[model samples]
Target: MNFTGQWVAFKTIVYREIHRFMRIWVQTLVPPAITIALYFLIFGQLIGSRIGQMGGFDYMQFVVPGLIMMAVIQNSYANVVSSFFGTKFQRNIEELLVAPVLEITILLGYIVGGMARGIAVGSIVTLLALFFTDLTVNNWWITISMVLLTAIVFSLTGFINAIFAESFDDISIIPTFVLTPMIYLGGVFYSIDLLPSFWAKISLANPILYMVNGFRYGILGVSDINIWQAYGMLVVFVIIGFSVSLYLLAKAEKLRT
Candidate 1:
């Protein structure tokens, strides 16, 4: 397809994705905001009071950025996986395959859709957080860039997961088993510096740690991980995720044909 044709296709897919979640805002958007609010209340207030400050800031402050990142990661991944998997389940993906749209255009459409949800949910979570603690916003660039890039990475991964997913059950497995564990341990609740020398080293292996800390640095000016290294890692993941998602998507189409 020509550039205009591809652009039209991309917009259509993105509009469908945005509409899909927005139509069910109660289910897709509201829950995460409520869940993060609970985290602020229970962890940031009730427990944080007794625990004292973390990473040189109020406990609530320390946790706010991580909570936002959490929302972004979860929503971004969920949006794409569910949307794309639904297309697969309904077998309308064949329509896309036969359509004049390029694969990259389709991929970008879904990624942007996922990004919209992630950023939207993250914004909601951030707004809820304001009721609990003030965000000084140490660096606007890092804060904005981190959230956008992080959302993109997860969206691509979600696209990949959808490509390989065989059943509805398969889509939930990674979020439940892999993503949940990573987010909790990803420096959301506490700094890895608090970990013992040995465990702290192991924590570095968890890629989510870098993202959480990078974003944390953006708001609170503190992070357990180096900011530059975190950006580097995120960039690398973006490249790898995009390449892999494209390959898997092509493979899936070939198999479907």
Candidate 2:
């Protein structure tokens, strides 16, 4: 349709998404804040006390970036997957597909929604973290850029998962079995450098590692991997996720059936 039409459609989708999550702030927003606070209390305060320093920062400080990134990744992914799948389950996605809106527009509308939730939740978690440690931004650009890119990548990922999901259980599987492990092993609580040589090399395979390290570098000015490499990978994943999501959306028959 025309530019104005597309803009209206986009705004409607984003507004709906924002409103849905905000309407249930207790579920979407409060849970992450409480969970992160518990992590700070248990991992940062209790265990971190005995662990002392990691990568030249206090254990609590070192984990702040990772925890925030984790919040962004999880919420961004969950928001889109659940929202898109809900549309599918209700069989309302066919309406959007038959409408004049472009496939990319639909993809982006959902993505923007996911990114909004992810960034919002991440910001809240970051604020909560301040109570436990003196967090500083070593590189504002890198920090913000990495977080934004990571959110987009995962938002796209959630869209892909939603397309392939046949049931509600399918949506939970990847996050439980796949995403959780990746995040934990992604260097959220510890650095890969602390791993033995062979295992450290293996950690490189986890995409979350680059994201966590890039974010940590932004916050702490240190990283086990080159920052540029992390930036490149994040961009590449965004492209791949976007392409896959578009392809799935194009298969309207398969999706609607």
Candidate 3:
């Protein structure tokens, strides 16, 4: 496709995905906001009060970044996985495969759409959190960069998962089993500093921990892991996911005969 044609295709896919989620705002957006509010009330207010401060900030402030990132990660991933799999189940993806547009463009377009929704929801959650606490961003660039990169990584991941999913239940497996555990143990509720020496060392192996703390450092200026290392790992994941998603799309891996 020519530049103009590519632009049109990209815009159409993104607009369609955006409208899809926005039209069902209750399902796509409101749930995460409500969930976070509950977290603030229960974990931050009730349990957190007894738990005491972590990494120089109040419990609510420490968790705000992780919560926001969690929303971004989950929604970005869920949006694309479901959106792409729906197209596959309906056989609509064949239309894109048969079109003159390049596969990389198609893949990137959908990923961008997912990232947009993720960032949008995360931003809303952040704004909502502000109403309950006085939060400050220690480094705007790192914060924004990490969030964007994390969204893109998960968005691409969702696309890849969709390619391999064979049923509706398949789509839910990763989020339920893998993603949920990662987010919960990802240093969201407590600091690694408080963990036993052995457990703290083991937690380092969880990649999500890096992202959670990296974002926390960006907001609260503190982290259990090196902030730069977190940024590096996220960039690497983006590159790897983008490359693999492009390859799958270009080859029409599961979509074409």
lDDT, candidate 3, equals: 0.89
RMSD of 3: 1.1
TM-score of 3: 0.97
Query: Could you give the candidate ranking by TM-score, starting with the highest?
Result: 2, 1, 3
Which of the predicted structures, 1 or 3, would earn the higher TM-score when compared with the native? 1
The local distance difference test score of each candidate is 0.92, 0.94, 0.89
Question: TM-scores, in order shown?
Answer: 0.98, 0.98, 0.97
**Error in Å for residue 106 of model 2:** 0.3
Candidate 2 lDDT (Cα, 0 to 1): 0.94
Residues 121-205 of candidate 3 have per-residue lDDT tens digits of: 9989999888878888999998988888889989999999999999999999999999999889889877988999999998898
lDDT value, residue 86 of candidate 1: 91
lDDT for position 87 in model 1: 91
Residue 184, candidate 3: Cα error in Å is: 0.7
Most lDDT-accurate candidate = 2
- Per-residue lDDT of 1-257 in model 2, one digit per residue for the tens? 89999999999899999998899899999999999999999999999999999999999999999999999999999999999999999988878978899888899999999999999999999999999999889999999999999999999999999998989999999999999999999999999989999999999999999999999999999898999999999999999999988988887655765
How much is the lDDT of residue 212 in candidate 1? 96
Model 1 C-alpha lDDT versus the unseen true structure: 0.92
